[model samples]
Target chain A: MNESAISIKDAALDYPRKKKGVGLLREFITGRFKKIPRKDRWFRALNGINLEVKRGEVVGIMGPNGSGKSTLLRVIAGIYAPDEGSVEVEGRITLLAGIGTGFNQDLTGRENIKLTGSIFGFDSNSISDMEEGIIDFSGIREFIDDPIRTYSAGMRARLGFAIISNLEPDILLLDEVMSVGDYEFRKKSRARIDELVQGDATVVIVSHSKSILQSMCDKVYGIHNGEIVTDGEPDSAFEFYESEKE
Target chain B: MGVSENKVLRRDGKLPFLSAPVKIMQNLYNYRQLLKHFIGRDLKVRYHNSILGYGWSVLEPLALTVTFYILFAILSDSEDPYRPLTILLGILAWSLFAKTFSNGTTCIQRNSSLIQRVYFPREIFLFSKSGYNMFHFILSLLVIIPLLINYELMPTQQLILLPIALIMILMLGTGLAFFTSILQTKARDVEHIVTIGLRISFYLSPVFYPLEMITGGRIPEQYAEAYLIANPMATYITMIRSAFTGAPLDIPTMNLVITFATTIAIFWIGSIYFMRKERKAVKFI
Candidate 1:
């Protein structure tokens, strides 16, 4: 067995812009009534991108906005299917993006924790066991019983990070998660992530921060125009990305 | 790297139609906990901060029943004993269908935020929204138990049919929902179309009035049976009413058979359509 945590072979994904209501309706009416032909518009988000992560490696992906970073992550998470090639992921996985990735605003903080935990494939007993730790880490004791809509953005992000960081998934996909918190919380989050990586959890993170990538990732891949342009150690990849940006 | 190793997860485009039904069931079972959470979220959000809370679930149908009773009171002074009970039964049965359909159609769009964040069975969104409505339907039945007792409508062997009728409504509502929710994901106009269609369906079916009004005299004799078979809601309401009040079923036996078959067909077809559409639909969202 190769013991690979993630694998992508020549993956490509595109989205259709002209297949929605107005476009479809216009085409239908034209074809049936007006006898006209219509063309469809397409946007290719990921193009022939191939990468793999071994069982215990921490890899960071960096790219400019709209360069398909999130799209690639989504593809690997099985949330979006690649238009070409294939993606294979082994082990339990969770994608943690911005604050409140799966929290319901109307639910109490406690309720939201249970809900998000279940959605992440945690059993009820596991969620119950982690309840006190999550609440304590979030430090939102007063509002833990209040609806999530009442919490501040910082509070919500704190709660979200706390719960996600506690989960012991074999694979973790993080999308710019460290950008949300204050300095102290970010430090705590970094420590928690370091602990997970130390415990042999495979991690893939996407971030715009070169410093963050250089600090945490064993290998870094720089993406440009929907393809990986640089792959190597953190310093070399960051250097290549910086020169390309200039 | 081993090229032929078994991958734990793979996203091949478009599953085979033969596997769609089984796949949907598998996803439902795997995501049952998420479905339960969503149901709880729905019920809590709906009743939170309301003065009456869960009482509104019972009161809404009861109030509608009273309004229709008053309106129908003017139509004829026939002195039929089961009129009010039948009317209540019809309203309750039809609302279950209507609420589930309306909520299920828009549920995917409503959970667009969650869709982008996680990958579970998308149908869980549809089921959870309808599931709470089903819960409300069950709770409302409690209110009617007193009414059933007050009217001395004791249980008969036919009472076994009550659960069957309710299950039929759930299947039919969910089937229509799966179809509409997929369409609404691509086109917002489907929502408006569904709303208008449902309203017209309410009028065409025997929700506010008795089935006798149509079968007895209004329409020509030959078309009456066709009309009942054409509108499954009317047949469903009649069955539920017959089960509860022990009234003779005005609906033909063949009509019941056709309705059941049609409900199953729609559910199967809807599952097929939804699974195919769901894979491509996430990108649009």
Candidate 2:
């Protein structure tokens, strides 16, 4: 019970920069036959990051564009293996990034719920059990049966948020999803997230919105140039973040 | 407290070679529901708007069979009565391999959005593509039933080879898919090369002809066994055709054994290659 929900130690991830035309082709062919020394090719996305999230904690990650905030979440979610160091997580974890992640435009909103649910490893019976709740929460009843391509951006985001929130993983990773939808929808989602956080779910929210982080996060980490520049209470973290911005 | 129960990921952590397959099977079993959803989505998205729906699955191979049948009839003096049946079987089996390979290679890139945001077994995408094509192959096989009835061919014990041939083809196709899907993410040219390779392999394979054309005299008798061992698809298609036409499985025992062993080797090697490159491949995509 005392164990942290998520822990990382000195994790680093690097992505290769883009190469055009002949150089890429040569690299590709050589890469197949031999391990061409690629030390110079990689751009470090996460640099020696160390983080720990206690159970029932609400953590916020604030960073500028290209500052490795998303990559850090992905590593915790197990979508990317760090190039160095280690990561450990207890309990089930789910990362919901962007609106309508993996929605088939041709499928109706009702069907896409089941599809996305299964993508999270939920069985049919459980997904079916949660179907009505998701639909009710999204409040897109009339358009639920219509293909998602016909739904507006806000409607798609609403449906997407509804499905993930209902699943209720032990650890939730949110990346800029709260920035979408209308003001009313945002308030509703914020309340729903509060309920989960209060019920002892570990939450990690990555956003550029300073006020949202300050109000919601128990602790905020400000990342700059793929490294944490500040890790403290929201006020101090924001102070460092604002100074860096100027 | 119970660190053993927690999931730990390290850069150098890898399951031993002997246990890798067991671990993969366990992972696949746990995510069976996701695999089912993926396969269902593939089927729906493919035939959703088509007028004929699943009927097109049968029609495509049938049309190809007729075209090949006519061309062969004009090109040669052979009056083989089971020509159409064998061609259809070959086309169906070959399409399963071709579609699985070509689609499997690009599956990672095609599903890059889901791959980036979600964390399920990436192998599910490749299997779903194979399963979708396998479903079409089975549907198309139903077209051969009437041909069998017309020819007065009864279901023989040889029909048992059908599933055996299927597993071999699936193993080879899915195996190659596992390897290439990762590579294709890094180099887009892999797909183009696979396309041209499949086109040439169609003629090299016994899709529109019988194995007799090679074993009889076209290929030197010394290299006949070597040919079968080199191209496992030739043996697989021949097994499928013989199962339907009740033609004797003329493949030698040693040749069959070697081809089956080679097929398994390809599957194993491809899987290992995929596992090693998978983490790196995702970054490139």
Candidate 3:
């Protein structure tokens, strides 16, 4: 698993976006099938995305909206199938891309922890053991027995983040790291990310904040129009990103 | 980690993305947990809105029994001697089937947030809905305490068979629920169609009247037996209803055979179909 690590070759994503060229009714009827005709189904959300991240290397992705960043993240996580190529993840992978999104609002925090852990592939006994660690980290002990719907956004995010961290994946994927929680909780998340990267874990962070890009990531890819327009050292990627803004 | 970067793309035709068999095996275990989580959430949430918390589990069913007791006693001109026990089991059993059927059909769509984002075995949602309703259905039957005694519908030693019969009914409800839930996931219109189907199923089953009384023994014996075989509940209710009537149930061998076969077949087919489509349930949502 260590030598094999994670690699992607020629991976691509395409999503159909409706163009307003035709009459609404005629377009609507055809839209029910393949839509936009066979020639135009592809928006080419990610164009031949290729990369190799060795064990324990921290990889960061910096991009604007619709730059195919999250699409690439999902591809690596195996949530979406690649149309053009394949991804080989040697070890177990976990994506911390969502916060409490899989949590059931009707379930208590304790129940949700077990249910969510199982949903992501852990067994029941492990969930019970991990429950304490999850609860301790989130600092929401008193309300752990309460339903998640009662929790505020910060509280829910803490729980979601805590569960993802408990997974301890060899390949850890993060999206919009700065946007996780309130400023106070975001500080906690940053510390956790730093601690996780210190281990043998490989991390890929997707963020638009230049400060984070400069401080955390050694390697970065500046992407636009669904392609990696620049790939190199962090400073170099940012230099290309800045020039693109003009 | 993978090699042959330049020469390995030799396939003439593309295959389906995920292996069908492996996915089914994985989903079988996955759906069990999903069933637990979804049902747990529903059971907890249902009482959260009520001041009674969970006593509504007992209170709601008891109230329904009382209302029916009064209505059936006064409204019907020609009430059968066993009418009290008849309405009691009939209404409770029908409610269980109806609730499980109607709600299970809509479960995959209802939990789009949970299903759409993550990959999970889809039948978990269906099983959860059925599991939650079964909890309520069981709690509701406890209301039969006074209702049974006041009407002198209290049973003989044959009443000990009540627990076994109830378990069978639960299995039947689960089988029907699992089958219908998977069907409805593919077709949005199936939800509406199922609601109507449940109502018709209630009439078709020997819920309200005894099968013997419904047709009168005038119908040929083989046809009546076949009808009973086709309807598991017809046999189910006929035997169990007499638990209240305090009479010996001449259980039919053929009826039991049909009940056993239907239960196993539905579970097997329902699980396979549900597993196949389970991955895509979230995608559609």
Candidate 4:
């Protein structure tokens, strides 16, 4: 009955690192990403969060490190589900796994371009059509046919960002990836964000950069200790977040 | 608390990629390409500094095959001239299986840096091993061609089934791999134990010799048969040998049932455990 497209209720996240005691035999039975042994040692990455985002809205979450800022983003991305509470999400969510995640070091730049395009949901045939645009946007025309590993991280990031930007998702999540590369390129990334914002897309950005969130976010919440300490104006949230800093 | 407010704007800007969860699977489907990229990366990285490069894939198995052949051909007291062929079947299957399983065992742990932060599906990484291992397996097949020619063995219509046979090995590998990748990542020593386990299994599995070789001419027939069918890797090697020898596989129709059921069960348990562990895998790294 709720009209909100995304909702989280009392969501909490805990992660286990390492622990001793489980008999030598049972340890191998556990999954690497599970929280079986860290019962006492687990870090409460995200405490509890209550949120609702409707269609055609943009929300920003900002906080200090370990304040569940990135944890919140990861939970929403379905990378982590809350230990408790229900997370009901409607519509499409686009989670960027970074620029280099979908690229190959061994494959030629041409091959990497196609590979990246495919990860954006386009088929090889479709990628071939967009080949020229990818090369142009990346601005590494000469290296387009070379293996991507030979390219610098900047070049790789540019190529990666270029591929995803073309896919056009209904909702987009960014995790400080835009902060990479040069100032000129960051400006380009911001401009691209503007393009997505103007459309029907809903957006969520996680960052420690107050100025950037203040300038671009319509509403921002300061998340601390796994709960929303303050929610409302980005200026006020940032102010509250900064004042609370010890 | 609700996004329904029309004047919700707090005079702040917006967030980045608002719909990441909804896009997880969508991105993953798109990730088939990404998976290929990773597989390509692994293969290239493995061969990077080597002289023969990927030719090593073919060469390694070939050399092992030769060592086994020479020992059985001229050195063994057994009069069976077919001993060379038998050893070839065993070594090829064993090495590939051991290499794939052990490599996959560390697939996630080695990449923990990326695993802890990234929002991509973890299974895709487990699946990436499948891709890379299979690629290497295919490259190794190049050796089979020359070996076949030297033996004067003609290609058979049954060779079309080779792809199917290899898929079975991978499916079996996937079950062990998917399970072990998660298990070892959670428990560090699991990989070390599995490394030794594979070594012992190489000697125990039907790879270096037929199941019949293990049971003397005096052992009960059905019991040895049962062990071959039950030992996880045993059937895999048997089927592989069947591929080359053109034998009937002698597996019960129900054997496929067992393989199918175990495949699903291992994959199901492994995925559940991995997903359960997904949140924590990040913390360790």
* Best-fitting candidate, scored by DockQ: 2
State how far residue A86 of model 1 sits from its true place (Å): 1.8
Candidate 1 clash pair list = none
Question: What stretches of model 3 exceed 4 Å from their correct place?
Answer: A5-54, A62-64, A75-93, A98-118, A121-150, A209-246, B1-41, B45-51, B74-82, B116-118, B145-193, B217-267
Q: Which ten-residue region of model 3 chain A has the weakest summed lDDT?
A: A18-27
Q: Which scores higher on DockQ, 1 or 2?
A: 2
Query: Candidates' TM-scores?
Result: 0.92, 0.92, 0.72, 0.77
Residue lDDT tens for model 3, B1-285: 101111111111133233533544554554565556566667767777665876766665556556766865677565477665576677777777677767877776676655534444455565566678878766666766776777766458877656656656666666566655654544556667777877787778767655665445657877777777677776667666766667767657766777768866665665555545443333334
Best by lDDT: 2
Q: Tell me the spans in candidate 4 whose CA falls farther than 4 Å from its real position.
A: A1-5, A17-39, A90-92, A95-102, A164-166, B1-54, B111-121, B146-168, B218-230, B247-285
Proportion of true contacts reproduced by candidate 4: 0.14
- The alpha-carbon lDDT assigned to residue A63 of candidate 1 equals 76
DockQ for candidate 4, C-alpha atoms = 0.16
**What tens-digit string does per-residue lDDT give for candidate 1 at A53-128?**
9999999998778788888888888888787888988877777777565677788999988888887777788889
TM-score of 3: 0.72
The positional error of residue A107 in candidate 2, measured at the CA in angstroms, is: 2.4
TM-score of model 3 (first chain only): 0.88
Judged by DockQ cut-offs, is candidate 1 incorrect, acceptable, medium or high? acceptable
Candidate 4 per-residue C-alpha lDDT over A1-246 given as tens digits, one digit per residue, 9 for 90 to 100: 346756778777776534333324455445445655656667777776888877677788888777777768767755565677667665545665455554556777777666555444455577777788867776778888777778899988888777666656656777764654788877887687778766787778787788767766778988878788876678788897788785
Best by TM-score: 2
TM-score result, candidate 2: 0.92
